[model samples]
Target chain A: MIPGTPNTVALGIGAALGLTLAVAILVLIRRDHLYIRQALWWVAVAAVALAVGVFPAGMDYVGRALGILYPPMLAAVIAIVAMLIKILLQDVAITRQERQIRRLAQELAMRAESPSSKDIS
Target chain B: MQDTLIVIPAKNEAATISGVIAEVRAATSLPLLLVDDGSADDTAKIARAAGAIVLTPPLHLGAWGAIQTGLRYALERDYRRVVTLDADGQHEARWIPDLLAVLDGDAADLAIGAFPERGSAARQVAWALFRRITGLGFEDLTSGFRAYNAKAIALLAGEEATLLDYQDVGVLLLARSAKLRIVEVPVKMRLRTTGPSRIFSSWWVVTKYMLETVLLCFAHWNRTGRQRT
Candidate 1:
C-alpha cells in the first residue's frame, strides 16, 4: 500500500542475494555430501522467496521474469523441500548404520576365528 | 558304581574353581574335566591346581561350545556318563549326588537340575516362553546344571550339539527329539558372587537370547513332530 521505496527494495534484494550466494557456495563446497546438497537446495529456494517477500522491486521482476508474484506459495514449496531433505537424510543415516552393523559382524567373526586373539574373561 | 566324568565349563572363575572342584571330588570320585573356555584369568591354572584335567580351547567358545568340547572329550575317553556343573559358584556342587543318583537309578537318560524356586520372575517368564516355543515341559529348559548318561553323551556328541550356540536348551530339545528320557531333579542354586548374570545384563542380551531361543524352538519343532509331554 505504501509508495515504492528504494531502501526497502535494496535491503530485501541484498538479503536475498547474500543468502543465495551463501547457499551456492555451500553447495559447491559440499556437492559430494548428500545431506548438505539437499539442505543447500532447500535454503536456496527459501532465500529466493524471502527476497521476493520483502523486495517490492523483486515483485515486478518476478512478474516479468516468471509471470508470478505469489511469495506465500514459495514458503509452502520451501517447507516441502525441507521435509523431503530431512527424510532423505534419515534414509542415508539408516543405510550408514546398517553398513556399520555389517562391518561389526564381520569383525566379530574374524576375531572369533583368529586363534591368536586374546582370551575373553 | 559306574565311573562318571563331570565336565565343568569355566570362564575366568578362578575364585571359585578350587572350591567347586573340591566339592565335586568330595561328593563322588568321578573324574572331573574342566574345559577352560579361553578365560583371560587364572581359571586354567586354578583348575589344574585343583587336580582336575583341563582342556583349553583356542578362543572363547562361550558356555555352549565349552560344554560341547568337554562332552566330546568325555566321549573320546569312553566315560559312561558326563555331568555338567557351573563353575560360577551359583550351582551347588553337593547336589551332584542327587543328579548322579537319578541317573544311576536309570530313571532317565538326562537329568536336569531345575532352579525355578530360586530364579526371579523375569527368568521364570523367559523359561515359560522357552517351554511354550520348544514344547519342552521341563521346569527349566535353560538350566545349565545337568547330567547326561552314555546314551545322552553319544547322541549329543553328534554334529547337532556341536553346532549349537547355546547347549542347555538345544541339548534338551535334541535329546527330546531323539526320544531320550529327560527328568528334572530339585537342586538348590546359590547366589552368584562373581559377576552379573548374562541374561539380565541389558535389553540387548535379553532380546538376542529370546530370538535365539525362538529360532532353536522352530528348528526342533520342524525336525521333531512329537512334543514333549
Candidate 2:
C-alpha cells in the first residue's frame, strides 16, 4: 500500500515474468540443456521474483527496514550481488575444468609416447 | 641410464627445435622430451626427426601447462631429476649440467639458471617488483631454465600445481611453500630468435600479467612464509 508501489497491472506483469522464467528454466532442465546445480540458483531467483510480485509491498517494506533510500535500488543491488557470485562460481568451475582438461591432454600424450606391451616385450 | 630428463616445452618453434635438441643431445645423453604445445607449425615432426621424444598436447596448454606435462612424465618414469629449458634457444644447453650440479650438491632443491643481462629494461622492472613483493632473491625470476629434483618434480606435477598459469612466480611460491631450497646459478643466454615472449607479447598482456602476478603474490604472502636462499 506504499506510495509508488507497483500497480495491479505491473504486479501481474511481474508475476507473469517470474512464471515465464520458472517455466523456461524447468523446461530447459527437463531437456538436459541446463544443469540441475545451476538451475537451483535460477529457481531461487524465480521464487523470490514470484514472491515479490504477489506481495509487491514486501520489497518496499524490506527496503525501508534495511534503510534503503530508494526501494527499487535494493532489487538492483541484490541482482548485482547475485550476478557477481554466479560469475565467480562460473570462473571457479572453469578453472577446475581447465585443470582436468590439461591433465587429460598430458595423459593422452604420455600414452601415445609409451610403447604398447607387444612392442616393448 | 641417466637419472635426469630434460624437458623442453615448445610452441611453434619448428625453426629452432632441431638445433635445441641437438645442443642438448651434445651436452648430455639425458633423454629429452619436447612437449609440443599444439604448435601450428611442424615443431613436433622436426623435434622427432632430431631424435627427441615428442609429446604434443591435443590442444594448447599454455607454457605452464606444457611444462607441467613434462614434469608429470618425469615423475611417472621415476626420474631422479628434471631440467627444463626454453625451446626458443634462450637457455644454453651447456648450463644444464651446471644447474643440475646445484641439485647434486644438495645446495638446493631447485636450481635456476639466471642470465640477468638477458632481460630488457621493462622486464628488469617487473623482476624487481616481483622480488620486492615475493621476497624471492632470484635475479632472473622469469628464467625458464631451471632444474628440479624428484621431490620438487613430484610436488609440481601433482594436482596442487595444476592450475598455475605461469611457471615463474607461482612455481617459485609453491616451491617455497613446500620448503624447497632454491638457488640461482649464473649462466649465459642468447637472445631469442623465434616467436615473441608469451608474457610480454603485448601491452595488454603485460598489464594483465602484472595484475595477476601481483594479486597472486599478495594472496600467497602469508602461506609462502619467509624466503630462503
Candidate 3:
C-alpha cells in the first residue's frame, strides 16, 4: 500500500472500470470495426488505465517522487496530457484526409468537365 | 484574353448567380467556370443556364476548396492566367481587366484587387492585425477578386496548399514564401448583398480566424524555411 494510500474500494472500482473499457476496445477490434493502427493506440490507452487501476499505490509513489504535493491529482494530469497528445495525432490524420478528399473532389469535378467522360456518365 | 479563365466558386447562390454570370459574360468574352460546391439549391442548374461551365465537387468543399478545384482545372487545361471573384455580387466583375493588367504587366505574379474603403470596422481591424503579424500590407487582404499567373496557380494547386485553412491570407502567404511578386490594386467593392461574413461576424469568430491563420502562417513559414521576407 502507498504511504498515504486511499481505501482499497477506490482501487477496486478503478480496476473494474479500466477492465470494462479494455474489453470494450478489444470487442471493437475483434469485430473489425476499428482500424488496427487506430485501435492499437486505444488499446495502449486501455493498458495505461488498467495499469493504474492495478497499482494505484505506484501512482501515488511516483507522484510524490516527482514532487507533486497531491499525489491523487497525478492521474488527472496524466489523463489530460494523454488526451492532448491524442488530439494532436487526430489532427495529423485529419490533415492527411483533407488533402485526399480535396484531390478526389478535384479529380471527380475534372472528369465531369471532360466531354467524353461526360458522355460515359 | 482568350487564354484567361474566370473561376467563381458558388454555393446556395441561387438568388445572385444568374446576375453575376451575365455580368461577367458581358464584361469579357472570357470562358467562365462556376464551381457549384455541392449547393443543394439550383446553383449548378442556374450557372449552366446562364452559359458558364458548371463544375460540381462530389461534396461540399468550402469556398477555398472549390477555388483550389478551379485552379487545378485551369492548370490541367493549360490556361495562362486565372481571375477569381465572388458569386455573391459583392465583388464587381468590371474590374476584371485591371487584375489581368497587373498579371500582363509583369508587375506581380499575383494581382489582388483590394478595396480600401470597403468592408466593416471589424473586418478592417482584423485585416490590420493580419498585416501587422505577417508583415504583408494590403487594404483588403481578404479580397476574393484576384488574378494569378500559371506559375502561381501550380504552387497553390499543389500539395502544400492542402495545409491552408483559408484561401485569402493562406494563398498570399504561400505566394510570398515562393518568392512570387504580389501586388494589390485598388478595386471597387460593394458590401455583401446577402448573408454574413463568417470570419468577421463576431469577435469570437475573428479571434478564432486570426489564431488559426497565425498558427498556419508559422507552420508554413517554418516548413518553407522563411523563403522570403
Candidate 4:
C-alpha cells in the first residue's frame, strides 16, 4: 500500500542509479582502492534498490522473506556490511605497521650491543 | 707526526679483529685508539690484546654512538686527526692508508671512502634518494670508513654528535657547514661478515629505512642552514 505510481517509481529508480554512479565515479577518482571497493558495494545495493522499487511486488516479496519490519531495512543491512569490511581492513593495516616498527627496534638494539667485535680483531 | 690518530670502533669481532688490527698496524704506525662499544664477547679483550688502546662505554651505544664516543675521546686526548674504521671484516684495512694519504695530500678536513659496489638494490635506492635530497656528490654517505682531520672532528665533537643516530652522513653535513674541506676516495667494499643487515630485509624494511633517512636529511639541512645564518 506504499504509494507507488509509475512516475514515482521511475523517479526513485533514476535518482538511486544516478547517485550510485556519481559516488562510484568519485571513489574511483580518489584512487583509494578501499574506497573503490566500498563504492562498488554501494552501487550493487543501489541497483537492487532500483529493481525492487520499480516492481512493488518484488519489494513486498523480499521484505516478507527477510521479515524486514520496514522498506529501508535492506539498505541498512548493506551499509552495515560495508562498514564492517572497512573496519577490518583498517585493523589489518595498523597491525602490519606495528610489526614493522617492533622488528626495526629489535634490530637496532642488537646492532648497538655487539659492535662487530670479531671482525675488528 | 702526532697530527693523526686512528680510531677503530669495535664490538664483538674477535675472529677478524686480530687480522684487521695487524694489517692496520703494519700499514701505518699511526697511534690507534679503539673504542669497544660494550661487546658481550671477547671483543674488548682481544682488541686490547692486539695493542689497541681501548675505551669501553658504560652501555652499548649503536654504531654512530660508538663512533661519536671515539671522536670525543680523540678530542680529549688532543689528537689532530682521526680515521674511523669499521670493526666488521667487510672494510679492507689497506684502505686506511689510502684514506690517510688523501687526507694528507689534499690537506682535506674530511676524507670519505666511497665503496665501488654496494650490493643490495634497496641500499642503492636509498643511497640514490639520499644523494638526490642532500645534493652531496659523495657516492657512499653511510660508509664508516673515513678519515677526519681536527677541523672536521672538532665540528662533529659538539652536542649534536651525541644526538645523531648515524654519524657518517651527519658529520659530513656538519663539516660542510663548518666550511671544512671534504674529499671522497674510491675504496672497494666487501660484504659484511658478522650478521644480516638490520635494514633492507624486505620492501617494508626498505620503506622504513628510506623514511628515517629522509627525515634525518631534512633535520640536518635545517640545522646546517640555521648554523650558517
| Candidate 4 runs further than 4 Å off | A1-121, B198-207, B222-229
Better of 2 and 4 by DockQ: 2
Clash pairs for candidate 3: none
Q: List where candidate 3 sits over 4 angstroms from the true fold.
A: A1-18, A60-73, A114-121, B163-165, B190-229
Give the per-residue lDDT digits (tens) of candidate 3, residues B31-112: 8888988788998888887678778889777888889888988999898899999899988889999999998989899999
Candidate 4 lDDT by residue in tens digits, A16-115: 7656665666666477654665576556665665565456556546776888877456756765887798789878877675444433443443334333
Worst 10 residues of 2 chain B by lDDT: B220-229
- B90-205 per-residue lDDT for model 4 (tens digits): 77777887888877786687888888487577677777877777766678888888898777777776664555566556666767767788888899877887776645567786
Best by lDDT: 2
Query: How well does candidate 1 score on lDDT at residue B5?
Result: 82
Question: Could you estimate the TM-score for every candidate?
Answer: 0.64, 0.92, 0.81, 0.61
How many clashing residue pairs, candidate 4?
Answer: 13
Highest DockQ: which candidate? Answer: 2
lDDT of 2 by residue, B82-151 (tens): 9999998888898888999899999999999999998989999999999999998889998999999988
lDDT of 2 at A30: 98
Off by over 4 Å in 2: A1-6, A114-121, B227-229
- Candidate numbers, best TM-score first, in rank order: 2, 3, 1, 4
